[model samples]
Target: MAENQWSTAITSVKPNEIRVRGYRLDELMGRVSFGEAVYLILRGERPGAAVGRLVEAMLVASIDHGVTPPSTLAVRNAASTGASLNACIASGALAVNRHHGGAVEDCMRLLARGAARVAAGADLAAAARALIGEEKTAGRRLPGFGHRIHTDDPRSYRLLVLAREAGTAAAHVGVAEAIVAELAAGGKALPLNVDGAIAAVLADLGFDPELANGFFILARTAGWMAQVIEERRREKPMRRIDQGAAVYDGPASRELTQG
Candidate 1:
């Protein structure tokens, strides 16, 4: 390696071959799911089938949340102005700030704090309570505990169940649950939201907190594309993009057929 040359361990490109984390990209195409490939690329190792399934579930859970979300609105608004697909998608991605799609990383850090206290001989409930007190004293709101629309988030419940089934529900999951319990005991009664559930699962799965929000961005990209395409196909150019005014006129609820 020379001082003027940069290096990357993420991928290697040659004249006739491409490799990601030392595995040939072509070989990984059919042998692994997208979630498995993501894990392999990020962690530099393949995950078991169950873990891969859990990852895929997490992605599915966040694929869309309708037009009211800031990202979706941004996409639609940009598209209505006749923005290119890439630009519209960029608009959506830019909307994923600290309040919108960032709860995953924030909740991961909160869980880590509680987990560390538990590891240091504090009781789980006590640790959670202490964390709550600290955040209260700092006048900071607890992230990932509540939702504006959902009293009990279905995605949270499903993801937690899948995490347990995948054997990845460990310290962080326990801490998250303990926090929710403590919140209820304190009369707040905020249920764990999907972001919190993902945070716990990813923390237990040994992912870096900094990378947590990337999962949300990746999953929601599909939804952004859909919104952009719909805007381009159906809406008038330069129309006002009102988030709350939008109504669903799509297909009725239908069950998936069994294979």
Candidate 2:
């Protein structure tokens, strides 16, 4: 190896071949779902069949929360300024900071702390109550409970079901459920939102907390691109972007048909 040369184990490039985590890129193209490929590239191992589905569900759950989300708004605003696609996407990515698209990582850390308490022989509910009390005493809100919109996030329920079916519901998931139950029992009733569910599922699936928000960024990139395209095609340049004044005129309720 050359002096001071950097190296990465993520991918290898040769004259006419490319490999990711030791799998041939061309061969992996059609054989694996994007979620499975993502798992392989990130974790350096192929996911079990059900794990891929759960991962895909997690991606879908955060694909697009609408124009109100900061990321999407950033994308749209950048697009309206006649920015290039990459630049607009970069703008959106930058908006995914601590308060916006970061709940997954934050919640994963919270769940990990609770899971560690449980591992040390603390009762799950008791641990949860203690954690909640600590957070309350600190005047800090729980990262993944409650939402500005839905009382019960449908995506959260679906993701958790998929996680259990995928066999990835373990300690972190149990801790999350315990926290929710504890909150409810205390008359607070803060439901576990989608971020909390993803955090638990990802933690149980052996993902590091650092990569939690990356899942959201990957999924939401698709929506950002769509928003960017729409902004370029429909709106005048340099116009103000207002989330509150936006209305959905694209489609009404619809059903998907299976072939």
lDDT of each: 0.91, 0.90
Q: When superposed on Cα atoms, how far off is each prediction in RMSD? A: 1.4, 1.5
Point to the candidate with the largest TM-score: 1
Model 1, 39-139: lDDT tens digits are 99999998999999999899999999999988888889899989999999889889887677888999999999989998999988998999899989999
Count the clashes in each prediction. 0, 0
Residue-wise lDDT of candidate 2 within 1-259, one digit each (tens)?
A: 8899998999999999999999999999999998899899989999998999999898999899989988899899899889999999999999987677788999999889999999999988988988898889998889888987788889999999998898789888998999999999988998898888999999999899999999989999999999999899889999988899998998777778631
Return the TM-score for each candidate structure. Answer: 0.95, 0.94
Q: Which residue pairs in model 1 clash with each other? A: none
Stretches of candidate 2 exceeding 4 Å from the true structure: none
